[model samples]
Target chain A: MDELLRPLVPQVLGVLVRRGADLATAEDAVQDALVEAVRRWPDGFPEDPKGWLVTVAWRKLVDAHRSEASRRTREVRVLHDVAQGPVEQRDDTLQLLFWCCHPALTSASAVALTLRAVGGLTTRQIAEAYLVPEATMAQRISRAKRTVSEHGVGADGDLGAVLRVLYLVFNEGYTGEVDLAAEAIRLTRLLARLSPEPEVGGLLALMLLHHARRPARRDADGMLVPLGRQDRSLWGTSLIAEGVDVLQTALAQDRLGEYQAQAAIAALHCDARSADETDWPQVLEWYDELLRINPSPVVALNRAVAVGEVDGARAGLAALASVPDDVPRRAAVAAWLHERAGEPATAAELYAHAASSAANLAERHHLLREAARLAPDAPGT
Target chain B: MAKFLLLKHYRGGPQQRPNARTPMEEWTPAEIAAHLRFMEDMADDLRRRGEWVGGEALAPEGAFVRYDGEGRPPVTDGPFAETKDLIAGWMMIDVESLERAHETAAYLSSAPGPGGRPLEEWIEVRPFLEYTPPVVD
Candidate 1:
């Protein structure tokens, strides 16, 4: 039932917005319609759920305007704007995405609006996922809608910002009761359908590739498992195949964006039969291309790790030196390099330091385990 | 998101700030009331932001207890740690980033002490380890 309504949330909201209802009011109207549907739809699913929602939401918007606009004689035209929306249901979903990710809004505001309008999530759900107050999230979404409405423009929303917001949603993974990563993938898939840009396909492919590896990311006991140590058979073959197909199609377009480059790297890893069988040289080439595409410190650090895999530990360490020390996981990478360089004591010490500074419990525990493993191997033990 | 524990110490920090020079007992009752009100207000503000998880003030005294055998408990007296022996209290907050955690901790540190002055105390911020599986490793 939820899957049925998810796509319609944005379409209905878009309809209301197109009818000259303010974006924020349109969102609230959609929300009210959703609540009414929750109450009424259990008896029987609406024949046209989108149409039902659009009518309900549009009525709500009209009622709201009547109560507020009774003071203004000119606002009496609200009735005339009543859309024959159910019959004229041209998909306005892509425009809604553009509206939510409008350049006038901040990234945080855009993210909140995108989640509520496109992802069909409640304000409370997004708040819980983001660890913010429900009121704060509500304010952010409303403010974002108003910002976009006031700065109303054509379909010129920065797709890059939309991609970033989607990536952030994916990175948040499952939080509270929301499977944000799955939602992000779903929304990206919709975007890919709407847009002809290869990067959109590339983003969808990248998400699929990473999501496919999620099953192997942790052991039965919920312990963090490094990619090399993960059981290869656990990887989702269908998702991998889908991701590879998407990546190949995107790459064929010949405009290499950051996401396509990243997907290519992920494909390289997925193609390998085993850890030892990985094509490190080819992986290194993608990293270099990624560096050219997006030269971030994190990327540099990741590239250094690849350098270590392709070359020797000493060469890896040299490459790592160029990466800023403040980057997260720098110590962990150094520890790995030192361990492979036959310096157990240095590795163990670095691992311990890395564990102390680790951002999350799993990574801290993993780093501590690495440290403990090397502690006995070192001369002191 | 990260959860951080901001530690307020009874007898800690490398050096005491100027506002903390006078003990709470020596301050006037009005000053003490004002300080407590500041704390309540701060906690209330955090609760409004949905960041405040919990906080509690501790009694001054404690003892180290250990298991002797299977059932017997042996307690040690007059042997407190040379450092961080007395924690006054702590506030737990869940925030978006390390920077937010630090900002919250700084706000807690600015709670009024004796003479209605900001303590500017050193509040220790420790992150709670998250148990969620990584999306990207």
Candidate 2:
């Protein structure tokens, strides 16, 4: 609930971990300290919240360790000395993020731990966002922390993994109690600031550019409005401008990554006044750059769509041949291509088939409608 | 109160509705979005009525496995071979009466399909064998 508190979580955690606190123990103490803050901080603000959290969490860590290991006067003396003195909080947020997103953990586990330690989201909030039971999420986080503690992602953890985890968070969308997309943007903004990596800026730009269209992404009844149909008037100009600015800055660095390339495509879409007015040639070019950076079936599938717009529907259909049928939504893309190619009958059949295997109700219904539109009785429901 | 499982099938159902005989793929993107919204709206409505239990849409791919032996491992087969049934997904609901359950199933079956027309797909409703509350001591 408190925006400021969540960011400080990883900052203070970095301090505790730096002082030789066990990763799991330090995380637990940090969480406890956060709980204490929620109850007491409203009464009166601490002179320095980060410092307060660090001190409290350190004390908890010391207590836990004291209970586990016999009190060596030497260790206790060292702990007491550190506790008594002024606590200094440094920006260990980036390092903590890298460690939390340890390569040893599965992406799901990495996401859970990162949201807790680096993103400062409560376990309950994270669980709610993921649509999993709180206890299940707790197990996931703790297990991830265990894996992290064992593997020990030494100084300067994997940046790629960190970015990937952040990307996954952003893509999880506005689900349940957490606006994970917003939270992702916030974290990426911090990473961009702390690390100064072009990819970090690229990621932030990509998020902002996509998020800028949030208002027009849905219709009055909360139905998803596809990009082509979305009202460009409802798009957030400020966010788009900020995203473009960030993207340009990143591009100027002379380093092109998937995020930057992807952001460029998003930027092109944002630049359009109308769907028909979109610069398809530029979009297709960017898709080429994206393919060069990250050549996957998903990218190939998307590139096929861009090909349709730039090279004509027939060419798009030809390009579609390269994408494996097993890839999700391949049939849908084929149906759209056929529709564009003026084969309404073929498109309708394809749409009907795709609907049967549609991933969700929305997709299924939409495909069904497309079939009906092209069927012999076009007017019938 | 009783609980019922409402099953949706991808390949097999009790005779398909003529209009919805078409698959979901042919629907326009807007139609798909509208159809999904309809399902979610139904869920939300059920929740408001205190009849919602749980629901999920399954991915298209699946396999049926039969346990073999400890060392041999399990044998696996496609979700359907000769068997025409290929379950797509399902919804579970708790209702005040069997009639309510049927009504809920009917409501789900009425979700908009192609041409903004009601799907009118037949829902196979089966009540839960046990109704034990999952409360722990």
Against the native chain B, what TM-score does each candidate's chain B reach?
Answer: 0.88, 0.90
Off by over 4 Å in 2: A69-77, B1-137
Candidate No. with top TM-score: 1
Chain B global fold similarity (TM-score) for predicted model 2 against the true chain B: 0.90
Task: Quote each prediction's TM-score.
Answer: 0.87, 0.73
Write the residue-wise lDDT of candidate 1 on A11-32 in tens digits. 8887777677777788888988
Which 10 consecutive positions of candidate 2 chain B have the poorest summed lDDT?
B128-137
Across B3-65, the per-residue lDDT of candidate 2 in tens digits comes to: 689998887767888856888998888888989999999887766444566789998788889
Q: Which candidate is the best by lDDT?
A: 1
Candidate 2 residue-wise lDDT, A1-381, digit = tens: 378898788878888777777779999999999999999999999988888898888878787778877656578667767676565647888888888888898777788898999888898998777654566568778877888888877776899999999988887776567788889899999899898889999999999999899888767875556788889999999999999999999999999999999899999999999999999999999989988888999899999999999989999999999999988778888999998998988998999998787645556666787788899778752
DockQ of 1: 0.31
Error of 2 at A57 (Å): 1.5
**Model 2: residue A281 alpha-carbon error in angstroms:** 0.6
What local distance difference test score does each model get?
Answer: 0.83, 0.83
Instruction: Considering the two chains of model 2, state its CAPRI-style docking category.
Output: incorrect
Model 2's alpha-carbon lDDT is 0.83
